[model samples]
Structure formats: C-alpha cells, structure tokens
Target: MSTDLSLFGVVNAGSSSLKFAIYEAESCLLSGQVEGIGVRPGSKARDAAGQPIPAPDVTRQPPATPAEALLMLLPWLRDRLGGRTVSALGHRVVHGGPQHARPERVTPALLEQLTVFESLAPLHQPHNLAPIRAVLERMPQLPQVACFDTAFHRSMPEVAQAFALPYAMTERGLRRYGFHGLSYEYIAGRLPELAPDIAAGRVIVAHLGNGASLCALQGGRSVATTMGFSALEGLPMGTRCGELDPAVVLFLLERGMSPAEIQDLLYRRSGMLGLSGLSSDFRDLLASPEPRARFALEVFVYRVARSVGSLAAALGGLDGLVFTAGVGENAAPVRAAVCEACRWLGVELDSEANAVHGPRISRPGSRAAAYVLPTDENLMIARHTRALVAT
Candidate 1:
C-alpha cells in the first residue's frame, strides 16, 4: 500500500461497456474502455497525456459475456502496466441501497447482498458487479473495493429522501434515493480548490449526458438531487423520460400496454429521442435543423433550468451553479440556454467563456456564480480504494 510503488485500478462497468483506469497514488497513468461488449465489440485507451494506447490483437476477440469481457480486459491492462503491480481494484457500483453509506471491501457476502438491488437498477447493478466477481475468482487475494453511486446522497435530509407513499410502503424501501453520487462526490471534493468562495455555500451541479441529473450540494454535502428512486427521474436525458406522472402508467395499462412495454417506453424510447424522432445524441440534435430537434433541445434546457430553481429552494438559496458530464461540459449551446433560463437565479452567461468551455463561465459580480467543471468518477473511486486498502 506504499504510495511510491503501488498502483490502483478503477473499474466502471456499464451495460455495454467496461471502463478502466490506472492511478499511481493520486495521478492517473492510463484510462480507457471496451465498448459494445457483446455486439460490434471494440476497445480503445489513452495515457495520462491523452496519447492513444494501442490495443493488442487479443482485444479483437469479442467477449460474449461479462466474465469473458473482464478476461479480455485484464491481459490488455497487464501488458500496459509496464512492470508495476496494481495494489487494489475499485469498482463503480450504481446502487448501494440504504445500508452501504460508503465504499466497502468486496466480499462474497457483500456481492450476494448487492444482488438484491438488481431489481431496482436492472440495467446497471448486475453489470457493475460482474467484473468484481470475475476478479475475485481469478485473484482471490487482490483487494477490491465497491464504491456506491447512492452513497453521496445519504446526507440528504429526511424530508428530501421521503416519498408521499403510505407509511408501510415507505418502510418497505419505496423512497427517494439519488443516483450519480460518485460524480457529484468528485465535484464536491474539487469545489474547495476550484471555487473556494462558494465551496462551502449552496451549489447546484447539473450532470448532463445521455443520462442526466441535478444535485444540490450545501457546504460540500448533498442535500437534494433531481434523480430519485431511480436514474429515470429529474432532467430529460438523451433517451430517458426525466419525470412522469404515475397515473400515465395506469392509463397505458388500460390501453393494453404491458408493464414491460411501458418500462421500455419510459426508459429507452422516450426523452429527446422520442421528442426529436432523430437521435439520443445532443451533438446530432444540435446540428440538425429539424423542428423536432430544436424542440427537444428546448425541453432539455427548460427542465434543467427549472430543476436548478427547485434545488435552490431546497438549499434556501443558491450561491453557485455548476455544469458537468457530457452535455454540461461540452455543449456550449446547452449551457448558454440553461444559464439564460436561470437568469432569475442571478446567473449571467459569458458567451466567450462558455464557448471555450470555461472552468468559470459566469460574469463577475453575478449573485450566483456558474461554472463548467468536468467530472472524474474514476479518480474518485481510485482515491477511496487507495485510502481503504492502505489502512
């Protein structure tokens, strides 16, 4: 666990991809992912300087299962490590339920307990745990850590985490549990260095991408967030419907739509894709002149701006607003529109700064500052693993 010689490996396994990074203490040496794991499989990587790390011929062997995918990834990772050894492995687990409030060491009992959460996050939980199990089988003594995406939001007040459901249902775990916690946690940790004035004040971070959410950070801790119960709530994402009325499900059922069909409609076929009738990619929609595409973009900005107000209200007021993730960090137009819509909150857009993707985009003296800070969940997981394993 000596920082001088030990390397830490971080894994973020998604439904269709496996992202990995190597860190020497606090510095990342390499990072990459294997995309389209089961279909049209391909892999790519880069070093700390952003130089492409060439893939070996063995990576061309497409993995048929999650275990197979890990098998393909490990050898490539080993060859890239030069001569150093990875002291411990950290994984990004999407849901930690109510009990796991922080990162914990990976164990068979923990894996079995985490499996019970798959029903709550059918698209992610299983995939996130697969590689951990595979590694445990292959290297039983290699210390592994499981970091929760819901762990950061455990700081939210009781009322914010509650639902209006019956007391019995509430007791049965039917309540709000925010997601994208790892990303938010990273942003929160960086605020002191990046925006010291408001680091301990009320701030709202918009994590926009194909899957989006807004988090309200008060004094560097989560007080509320847009995503609740599941990632499908809050902001309108690339393909997922952000917020919906439960009655709509009953209405669809009355019309003969099965629960499965409705679930697919809300989680996949809706959002910007359903609105634009074009694509789930913001880059694609931004370039298209189609009316539906423009409308989709409009809806996305409107929801994000509205959510900022809601989170601000939760914090009693707003001191700063931050944009992160794919759409938030790169899409200048989206940031422009969102900031403009949130002018009531005292955000003044600096077109020049935004166009260049600023670490700070709001004009000086604005009542509430705005920024575009990139998120690094992998680094956050690595730091947690290093700390836990070192001890």
Candidate 2:
C-alpha cells in the first residue's frame, strides 16, 4: 500500500533477552523486547509513544534461546511492515576483533570471523550472534548487517590500544578494543548538531548503562576509551568487576579456584550486585535504605568521575562531558554527584537542570559543558543496516 516506505529492522540480543525495533526511515515505528528467553520467555511491545501494543503470540511454546525468540519475532515484524519493504536487519554484535572497523554485511565468512571473537566476549558474543544465525537460517533472502560495539574505537592511536605487554602478544591481538561503539558513535554523530563547538573540540562521553564505559572523542572520533580487550575491563557495571590487577586472578587460582569460577565471580557476581549484596538496577539501589546500596552507588559515581578525569587527560583537556545511556540520562542524583566530583575540571552543575534531566546541565560559567543526551543505538544500527542494504 505504501510503496514509498521502506523499513529497517534492528536486533540487540543479550545473554537472555532479545530486544527489537522497526524503523521507517529515521523514525522508530515499533519497539519492544522478548525477555527471559530460556527459563520463562515473555514478550512485550510498544509503539513509538511507549503505549502498550499487542505483542506477538510467542507463548505457544516458550522460546528456549535467543535464536528461537528471534524466529518468533520475525513474523510479527513482518505483519507490522504493512506492505512496506523491510530492507535489512541490523544486529548489535559485541566484538569485531582487530579488523572490521565499520558495519559489515553478514555472510558465512563474516560469521566465521565473528565466531572467533566469542572467546573475547563470552557473556555477550554468543547471544549477539544467535539472532543473526536464525535470520540466516529462516529468512535467507534478507540482507543482514553486523554493527559492532568495538568498531568505533578502531580510530584510537596504537599507543592507546597497547597494554604494555610483550610486543609478540600485542601483535597477536592482545591490544585494547573498546565496546559500546554503537552508543558512542551515535553520540559523536549527534554532538555536531547539538553543540558544534564541543563536537569539534575535545569531549568525553560516558555511556553509563548496565555495561558502562567512557570514550574520549576528539573531533568526533574516538581517541581513547575506558574498556579495553574485554567489556569487563573498565567501569564497575551491573554485575561485572571493573578494573582489577592481574595478580588477583593468580591469587584466586593459587587458592584453588578454577578459571570458570573466577569468571563467574568477576562477570556475574561482582559489581553493584556484589557490593550491595542487593540488586544491580541503579533505580533499585538508589531507592534502598541499606548502607550497602549507598556504598555501591558511591563507588559507581566515584569510578565514573575518576574515569571522566582520565579520559579528559587523554583528550589533552576537557571541552565537553556528555552523559548518555540508562543511569547517565535517568538518574539525577548520580549525575549531580559526578558533576560535583569533576568540579576541578570546571563542571558546575545547574541543580534545577540536572534534576529535570537536562539536555545541557552545566552552569554558564563552567569551563567544561556537561549534557544529558539520550543514546539511540537501535537507530544507529538501523542507519548502518539501511546503508549497507542500499549499497
């Protein structure tokens, strides 16, 4: 019916959930997720306005994996297309290794290459790839693209990627590879439109969600980022330990702990969850009366502030600080605390603006400007997918 309309589909699959969105040009038409994939699969969807919409009937037999969940999602997405051509599907792949500096069309060879990176991103890579495989199997005609989270940081200088390890190991791909490139890429692209002055100068963007990381962008390109080699490298996150000395792993091993046990402790049992011995959701932690919750919040804020300072140094100086993602955009208290800690960097928060979740939250007199710009990783994926498909 609408021959002029073409839609782009985006999939961001995690360890146990599948999030999806449909886009007509740049506007998101419908978005939602199928969560609790293995144990108790359930789906919920909403239109662009966030109003409830009838979700696809996925309960005939609960999906046992991300791929199965995706299989169920495809038909529903097709119905919503309403005669419009679905150009391509874009995936949020966690790692792209040393090569693949840009969005790539999914192919057998590309899938093989991406599979190798699973060891580098155990908690994420497998799930991120499952849906792509499902699309390949179930809808072979559809063109799919893999938009990597590590792709944007490929612009960083070699010195920033080095780990001081032996040259041999570095040559063998032991260097840093930043994650959350989709979000950072979106923020970088947006900055020029929102604040052209800072966009051309030095800026640090804090993508503070469940998987938190900071990126130093100079002239809208990544110069340095907090996460290196793995998503577990930087910023204490929802359930992952942020930065730790390598000797700690040796100590754990000498104590008879296996590598798997160490991985579990560091990846799924640490961070705000372990620190608070409570919940990992920042909203929950912020509201709790428990001292551990308060302590956990304090640690998160402190690390973010300290990391912002670190990234600022990488940029040579601070021109702008951007807060994006979940905790960055929604949590006013966290933003205020981080701004207070960065007072030395000339970030003076406008209390009223911060409380209201500002697009710009800094005082006019502050040397460095601070902003709360919500990230749209899904849209970024769609744009890339559409471009690749058109080409």
Residues 230-310, model 1: lDDT tens digits: 878888887788899989989999999998898789888999999999999999999999999999999999999999999
lDDT of 1: 0.89
Worst 10 contiguous positions by lDDT, candidate 2: 1-10
Cα lDDT tens digits, model 2, 1-391, are 4333278889989888999999888999899998888877788999988898999877788898989888878767777766565678899999998988999999988998999988778899999998898889888888889999999999999999999989999998999999999999999999989877689999999999888999999999999999999999999999999999999999999999999999999999999999999998999999999999999999999999999988888888998999999999999999999999999998999999999999999998789999999999999999998888887
Q: Among these predicted structures, which one has the highest lDDT?
A: 2
lDDT of 2: 0.91
Q: What is each predicted model's overall lDDT from 0 to 1?
A: 0.89, 0.91
Off by over 4 Å in 1: 1-5, 58-60
Residue 85's C-alpha lDDT in candidate 2?
Answer: 50
> Cα lDDT for residue 215, model 1?
95
Question: Per-residue error at 382 for model 1, in Å?
Answer: 0.2
Q: Which pairs clash in model 1?
A: none
